[model samples]
Target: MHEWALAEGVIKTIKEYSKDKKIEKVVVKIGELQQIDIDIFKFALDELKKENSMNKLSIILEIEPAVLKCRVCGKTWSFSENLKELDDFIAESIHFVPEVFHAFIKCPNCGSPDIDILKGRGVWIEKIKFKGE
Candidate 1:
């Protein structure tokens, strides 16, 4: 749902910013933390572009992984679990505010819960090709 919002926002932003410009290509950078559906987004992008006079538009998706650092040991690594495993962990932790499960979490290395999210949290419209009449 959040991914859909971001995707929709991207298209809206593109439309508003480009005005009369027609889009030919769209490149999106999705971070691992965002948990976005690339295929669904591709479908949404196609649907969005079809609503306009842009005729045919193509979209490309790029992936970026999130990195977490242990505040105690200074150990940093990419988030290694798939969505299902992450979901299970989240569900078992709090089940209410599962998002906060990462807060003040101790490092598995040094038993320090001071973990910092280092990367991969947002979506970016990396590049776009516009055909202007």
Candidate 2:
């Protein structure tokens, strides 16, 4: 699934970037809008790491809140505040394609459909620590 793919991507990226260096720790940031299953992602990472012979590597994941800004009113709000309004189908859609959020969500303050995603849209590596300084 996507989680597995994402895990593989992380491993591949680390391997490519840290060539010949042993990785000590990797800090990855997960955007809430992606709706990734943290437990599954971690498991995938562990399995993939082992397969890649990265046994000593430590992976850390951080969840970032999805923030949206109203284009009309300039008000910012957290996605969590509007989660209760989303149906299962819509949630699933956003999970796979976050851009779909624009169709389902609106500015909370101004009730405007014009909104901008301020943060928490994708996954990325925040920091990487090698085995030695």
Candidate 3:
């Protein structure tokens, strides 16, 4: 059901962008921190696309790695490196609200709580391929 809500939001954005234009394809980037099930998300997209009259629209999904930067030490690290340290509940917290990462994670280099998300936080439309070029 959560995936359905996300899919609905995506469809709404596509609808706005495709106003009076034919969309050949949409490339979506999914962030790892979101913890989205790709297959479920795709299924939701397909169902929503048909409901929104976008049956012809092609959707391409790309998964991006989560990267975090330490604001204090200027060191960058991959989120996956620390994933094993987190329990299921903590991971779920980050999945629902990425901003809460600061509450549970600290900089690996300097042990500072001040960190910046470099990439892979949420899903977004990366590129839209339109018909007829």
Better of 2 and 3 by TM-score: 3
lDDT by residue (71-103, candidate 2, tens digit) is 899999999888888999999998888899989
In model 1, how large is the Cα lDDT of residue 50? Answer: 74
Candidate 2: stretches off by over 4 Å: none
In the range 2-107, model 3's lDDT, one tens digit per residue, is 7778888889999998889999989999998788888899999999988888898899999999999998889999999878899898988887777878899999
Q: In angstroms, give how far residue 100 of model 3 lies from its true place.
A: 1.3
* Highest-lDDT candidate: 2
| Regions more than 4 Å wrong, model 3 | none
**C-alpha local distance difference test of each model:** 0.66, 0.90, 0.89
* Residue pairs with backbone overlap in model 3: none
Candidate 1's TM-score reads 0.70
Residue 9 alpha-carbon offset, candidate 1, angstroms: 0.6
